[model samples]
Target chain A: MKIITVKKIENAVAQLAREANLFLRKDVLTALKKSYRLEKNKRSKLFLKAIIDNAVYARKEKLAICQDTGLPLVFIELGQDVRILGDFKQAVIKGIALGYRKGNFRESIVSDPLLRGKPVYQGAVIHMDIVKGSKIKITVMPKGFGCENKSQLKMFLPTVGIGEIKKFIIEAVKTAGPDACPPYVVGVGIGGTADYASLLAKKALLKRIKLQRGLSPACPPKQQWREGTVSGLERELLLQINKLNIGPMGLGGKTTALAVNIEAYPTHIAGLPVAVNISCHALRSATAVL
Target chain B: MPYAAQQQYCRDCPSDGKIMKILNAPIQEKYIRELKAGDEVTLSGTIYTVRDQAHKRLIQDIGRGKELPFDTKGAVIYYCGPAKAPKGRVIGSCGPTTSSRMDEFTPLLLKKELKAMIGKGRRSKEVIAAIKKYKAVYFLAPAGCGALISKYIKKAETVAYPDLGPEQILKLEVKGFPLIVGIDSQGGSIYDKD
Candidate 1:
């Protein structure tokens, strides 16, 4: 068994927390630039330009791309053979606290949802998965409220069918409009339980934009098949979404959505759960393997 | 079919167009009611900061008839909760948060003689009603352009609720702060018309 020191995890979390806020991932940037070229509306075109310029400025200044430098969402893949030397949770929290403080990232986590109280927690959200390997993989995603507030989750009957799913996705985007900070990425999860579906939708967002070895990293390899075939479904959904003409900032343009990713799992015969998680262009997340 | 005076004025005006001046500023809210949509104004003054949590607390205090920690009358309120600043900087990527979340508390604040609000997105009907009733206006600074906006804020100091951390209310002194009119006192909204 391999022992990973808690200190290493702490340091990695802190550094990654800061880096994710300051830099736009290469995949996100490339997608945005592509949208900029393809967008037909003049107003949305200008808005997209400003977004790209903001990305550049944020990088040059080493500052957050947006003020709402969201809560620290840590996704951990723990290898079964590995053992942590110390308290893993505390180490991760410490890293998030230190990173946020040093980087000047905002503390968006509030102690209470209602009654308006102080912030009790430093990090935003942490999701962990235990795997077969001894190495631990940490993924940090700083999700701002703009896109987060627009997220929607619903459980439908098995008979609802694809037309209903398409309608739901479009309506979700329409209701969100400019509020989610348009020119966004939409992640859809089909099947699974309601809660599991919501999670799968979020994880679908972490899939890199680039094609790796002629296969989309956003979807699992065919050999490791899940309950249903979501890869083809995802590609079709992405094309339909872009046709919405929501544009940048919902100004009525061709580049409303950059990509749509779908993840699925087997569900009970009675239920067909679907979830949609929207993310803005910033799409800030980091991955570290130990 | 123009009146004599109007005819002369129309003839003198250029048919192509007139350049609209775009005023930019560090994010801050201060006396925004005095401004109107399509009116260009360069801002330089003191503005306070707050967001959903801060607004909720402030409104709750008002409901209890308790004194607020700061004087809000005739003040501009910026809808923001910036990231922490790097070493030696006044603030970090200080940009606007969404405006709609604070829509519930705005009318109450307006009753206190608050003048202006700065943020992005559409306000609720209650907020629009308050703007029309109280003659207050809302402005939009480009969202996601935090780093660029931070360059204009000359100084920032925490005024209250420091324990709120980033959500802490701050009193910021700004110079040449830039913005575009979003909601006018006449009940006109850019989001509505555009």
Candidate 2:
């Protein structure tokens, strides 16, 4: 059995938080650049340029990319054969608090939802999964509220077709319009229970966007999931969403969305649950494994 | 320098033959009246920043008839709550937040002669009506461009509500701050047209 210490986890989470806030992921950057190249609207091109430049400056200056450093969400994949040495939850909360303080990231979390007290950097939304091997992987995504507020969930009758699901996803993006800062990276979760679907949608945002048509990393070499499976659906949705003309900041352009990432799981025979989670251009997350 | 003479030939201006205008804050109504929706402009001089909490506090103060932290007459307010500055920087990544969140408190501030608001996203119809009623303008700073926008902010100091942390009201001196006119004084909106 591999023994993992809480101190190691704490350090990793802290560094990941800081890195995620300061650096725009390369996949997101590549997608943005491609959109800039393809964008026909002059105003949208300018906005895209500014966004790209902002990422550069943020990295150079070691600054938060956007003011809303967001609520820290830590996703953990734990190996069944690994045992943690110390208080795991406390370590994560402490790590996030320490990182936010040291990195000058804005603590966007409030103590209570309704009461809404002063912002605190105490806790993070943690999602953990038990896996096969003896390794611990952590990914920190600081989800900005501007897009997170626009997330939606729908419970569809099991008899419905793909057309209805597509419409619902399209409507969610439309309702988001310019409010959530398009061109968005749209994450869709279909199947599972309601809450699980929401979680799956959020997790879908972490997928690496495929810039070209090829095998996706999520699938095995023999599977060819990119052209034959859900990835085909992703491509179709991407085309439909960009047609909405809700371009960068909803100013109207050809690139309304950079990518559509979908995750699916088995659900009850009588229900079909769908959730949409939208992410802004500065899609920031960092991952580390030990 | 002449107000309109400093035009930089903005590439992002609306396709309506409107020349990019360079204006200073404490903006006059006449200058605002000259702007049309989709016009690209750069602002210089002082502008105040306020976000959700500050808006609520400002409204409460307005309700209680207390003196405001800064003069509101003919002033341009930016809807932003900036990140805390790191060492040696004047301010951190300061950029506009979603403007619609401030809709509830905007009309009362407009009644105090708030000339303009700078933010991202669409505004409520009530706020749009209020903007037209007050002949106020709404400007759009590029969303999600905080670090780039911070370069324009030469100075930033918290002016009120220190307890609110990043949500504190900030008085910022900006130079050549880029913006696009989202809604003009005459009920013209870039959002509607485009």
Candidate 3:
């Protein structure tokens, strides 16, 4: 069994925060490049180029891809076989503090939702899960409020048809419009408890766009989407979303969405819940396993 | 689904397409009226910064009949709350935030003779109508490309509500600050382009 120090988690988080903000993930990069090559509207093409160039400059200059380096959404997959150390929660918080200061990432969090005082990026949105491995894995998704504000969850009767889900997803993306920095990567979560469904949606975003052939058929469907296969509903939703043509900035175009990723969980017999999590083109994310 | 692609507005556009004519703030209505949606331009001169919190305070100040920290006439308000500069940089990644978040305050600000706005995302109908009524324009600063933008800024100083931290009002001296006309004096919106 691995004896990973709490200090290691702290240090990993600090570096993850900086790296997440500064770098664009490869999956997103590939999608954007493909979109840029295929983009017809000259205006949309120019927008795509700027997105590409901005990534380049961000890497070269060692600056955040966006001013809103965002409140950290820290996901920790702790190994059940690994031995842990000090106060884990405090270590995560302190690491965020160190990262915000050292990385010069913006503190976008407010003191309270209603009170709205000074920024409080010192704290993080930490999600922990226990896994079978001997090493801990950490992922940092810097979530800017602009897109997060647009995410939504809808609870439907178990009798709800896929058509209703499609409509809800379309409405969500349309309502987001230019506001979510169009040409978004939409994460869809279906069939879980309300809160858990939204979590599933966000988790779905961590998976790369399903540009490769549908999920591998040889692999068994172990829940948590280890198989990478797209259900019929997921494929249909992706097709319909791109048809919205909300385009790059909602200024309009064909490339309204880069990709749609869906994850599902078992739900109560009477409930059907759907959640959508939208991420802008900056899609700043990074992960590390120790 | 068969689809014919619709066009989105261009911001952070090509430097080669049109020779950018610069506008210095305290912008003139005539200059604003001459602008139309989709035209790219670079702004130079002084611009005032405000975000949701500062905008609320400024509106409150107006209602209270107290003086605003900066004059509203012929003014351009930039919707941003920039990160502090690292060593040797004039400003940090200073890109625009979503403009629609300030929609409620915008029409009121425009009524006070605010001439223009610079931010990303679309504005509300009330704000667009006010831009028309006031003969002003709305410009879209590219979203998420702040570091490249900081180079255009020559100076930045906190001008009001320092207590708000990043939400503090800033008076920035900028040079060739690129933007696209997202909405024009006639209420023509770039978001509506085909």
Which of the two candidates, 1 or 3, achieves a greater lDDT against the reference?
Answer: 3
Q: What's the TM-score of chain B for every model shown?
A: 0.81, 0.92, 0.91
DockQ for every model comes to: 0.37, 0.60, 0.51
i-RMSD of all predictions: 4.5, 2.8, 1.6
Candidate 3 per-residue lDDT, tens place, A1-290, comes to 88878899889888888888888888788778878777777777777777888888878887778888887899999899999788888888888888878877677878687998888667788899999979889998998878988999999999987678889988998888887677888888988799999999999888876454332211123343422345555655556777676788765667888877778888999999999998888887889998
Error of 2 at B35 (Å): 0.4
lDDT digits (tens) for residues B1-194 of candidate 2: 65667676544333223456898998999888888998789888899999898999999999999999999999999988888888998888877888999998999999999999999999999899999999999999888988778888999987988888778888999987888899999888888844
Best by DockQ: 2
Clashes of each: 10, 0, 4
RMSD (Å) of each candidate, 1 decimal: 6.4, 3.2, 5.9
What root-mean-square deviation over C-alphas does model 3 reach? 5.9
DockQ metric, candidate 2: 0.60
| Candidate 3 residue B13 C-alpha distance from true site, Å | 4.0
Q: Write the per-residue lDDT of candidate 1 for residues B9-43, one digit (tens) a residue.
A: 11111111222232223222333434566343345
- Lowest-lDDT window of 10 residues in candidate 2 chain B? B9-18
**How far is A7's C-alpha from truth in model 3 (Å)?**
1.6
